[model samples]
Target: MTGAATGLGLGIAERFVADGCVEVHGLDITPTPDRVVPGLQHRTVDVGDAQEVDDCVEAILTAAGRIDILVCNAAIMQDRHEVLQTPDELVERVLRVNFGGVFNLCRAVGRAMKDAGSGRVVTVSSQVAETPWPGMAVYAASKAAVTTFTRAFALEMAPYGVYVNTILPGTMDTNQMRDSFAGLGRMTGADPESLIAAKRTSMPLGRMGTPQDAANLASWLASDQASFSIGGVFDLTGGELWSRS
Candidate 1:
């Protein structure tokens, strides 16, 4: 699992471990403290770096013998700016980490899965890919790329019994979400709590989603129960996608 050190990624990794996965390897840029999960092994890796990602995958294979499931959840949401104000470097950096990371890992792990003839790849995208909130052009675009690429890749990998799917999560009460909201508030000179409360009220479900909600869906997607699911995008948006009120 990429980005398994925090937020949704950590939730997913925890679920996998709790589900009795023999070995769960978490790859992240941050240093994960020892024994975050009983059998979870943490590797500090910049997913944006292709070489680093490749080496990490190789190491996981060496240690675990096989990678039955891969969860691509490493991403960043930064510089909430309009396109005119967004820097070229920022765009490149976001794309490199958010989309390139997925590309590198999928290529590396997908090759291994192809050789093995069976594997599951569950990518965590965001509802913004389709919903298109302002000030999120770059992040949304990267996720859009991931959504489309995963679908196409799934078709290619289907012949080899590998299933690939994407998950689009809506507003969740994660540290990242809180941080992003705080940052946006700072930019807009608005109270973060007020902004967050407004967001909560905007959700048709009457509450913001939890990391566990996303983790539950991810766990399901990674299981054999989702065997027939392929190249599909699952939304865990708490009906926010349809709410315009």
Candidate 2:
């Protein structure tokens, strides 16, 4: 699990570890995370770097013998801007973390899962990939790529008994979502607080989604009960746009 230091990733890590039967090795760039618990081990890792990811995977394999589940949730939102106004460097940085991280982790971990002939891989992408607003161009594009990549990777790994799936979450109440609201404020000159409040109340489900919503769905997808699902894209968007993915 990448980005497990905070927000949705943290929620998923907490959920998985709460079972007591599972030992979760949570990954994040954070050197130290406050969400300490009995069965969870927080690991410092930058998932975007291929060599770093490979090394980390190797270390985990050496210690754990094999990984049964991998959750790829590490991502950075692009600071809000129009496509023309977005910096090329910002685009590269976001792609490296958001898309490239998934690529690297899947390659390293997927290879191991293939050899083991059984495993689950889940990726957290955003709902904005299909329903794009103005300022989230880069972020949306990156997630779109993730959705596509995860499905294709699933196809490749399915023959080896590695099930890959994607979770597209809606507007969750988190720091990342708040940052997006602030970016929207900068883009459209509307008060971020007002926008945030409006968004929460305006969702079809009558409120913004929570990290738990995402965690429950992701956990379900990674379970043995989800054996029949392959290359699936499950939408947890609280009645936002329905994805064809």
Candidate 3:
């Protein structure tokens, strides 16, 4: 998994360990937690860099001898801003870290999976992919690309008995989400807590989703329980994306 140091990545990595993944590697741009699981390995890596991703994957394969499961969960999202006002550099950075990172990781690790003749790849997308949000055009677009990429790749991998799927998570209560809303507050001149409260009010479930909520699906998809599942975009966004009758 990429970006497994915190937020959804950390939660998913923890779940993977609990679900009996003997050896789980957590890779990210920053140092991972020292609170180590005996079977878990931590590596600092920038998934946006192709060389870094390749080296990391190679190192893991050398140590583990095989790659069986891959979760492309690395992404970055800036506060919602109008497209015209959005800087080219910021847009490029988001796209690079979000979409480009997934591309490089998938290319490097995907080859291993294909060579091994089977693997499960779960890409972390966003509820925004289907339920577009104003001012978050870039993030939604990138996740839309992720979903499309998963579909196309799933078809290709199906012949090799490999499966690729996407997990669409809603607004989750994580440090990342807090930071995101805080950024939005700065951008919009509103109190961060107020914006978050408004978001909670909008959710039919009356609360934001959790990392574990998404991790449950990730665990299922990564296991043999979902062997027959492929090319699916599983949403864990509560009822936020649904229209009320």
Candidate 4:
């Protein structure tokens, strides 16, 4: 799991550990927490760095003997600029981290899975890939790119019996979401709390989703139950995608 130090990644990792995964290795830019369920190992590295990603995968393969399931959940979202006001560097950085991270990991681990003739890759995407929001154009575009690339990757890997799917997560009370949208609130004159409250109220569930919500979906996708489901995008959007006018 990438970005396993916090939010959705942490939640997903926790769920895997709970499901009796004997060895769960987490990779992230940040250090792992001091305590977690036993057998959870942390390998701190930048996912955007291809060399680092390659080394990390090699280490895991040497240690674990085989790769079974790979989850690419590292991503970043910046909300300060629209297309015109956006800097070239900013767009590149976001794409490099958000999309490139997935690209690097998938190519590295994916090769192993393809060689082994079986594996499951579940990538974390966002609802914004389909639903547009003001000021998040670049982030949304990157996810859109990911979603499309995910489908193509799935097709290529399918011949080897490896299943690849993208999980499109909607708004959730993640720390990253709060921070990004908080700034958005200031600029738009919408109170951050009210905006969040309104979002929750609008959801069919009448509540914002939790990290565990996404984790549960991921766990299901990782299991044998989802074996035949490839080249698919599973929505974990708390009904946000289906919300009506």
Q: How does model 3 fare in lDDT?
A: 0.86
- The whole-model lDDT of each prediction reads 0.89, 0.88, 0.86, 0.87
**Residue 92 lDDT in model 3?**
86
lDDT of 2 by residue, 130-208 (tens): 7888888999999999999999999999999999999988889888999999988988899999999888777887888
Greater-lDDT candidate between 3 and 4: 4
Rate residue 46 of model 2 by lDDT.
91
101-150, model 3: which lDDT tens digit per residue?
Answer: 88898899889988999999999989889987778899889999899999
Q: Write candidate 4's Cα lDDT for 1-245 as tens digits.
A: 99888888888888999999878999999876534656678889899999999999999999888888899998987866777888898898999999999999999999999889988899988898998778889999899988999999999999998899999988888888888778788678889988787777888888777889988888988889985799799988878887741
Worst 10-residue lDDT window for candidate 4 reads 31-40
| Quality of model 4 by C-alpha lDDT | 0.87
Identify the superior model by TM-score, candidate 1 or candidate 3.
1
Ranked by TM-score, the better of candidates 1 and 4 is 1
| Number of backbone collisions per candidate | 0, 0, 0, 0
- TM-scores, each model vs. reference: 0.96, 0.96, 0.94, 0.96
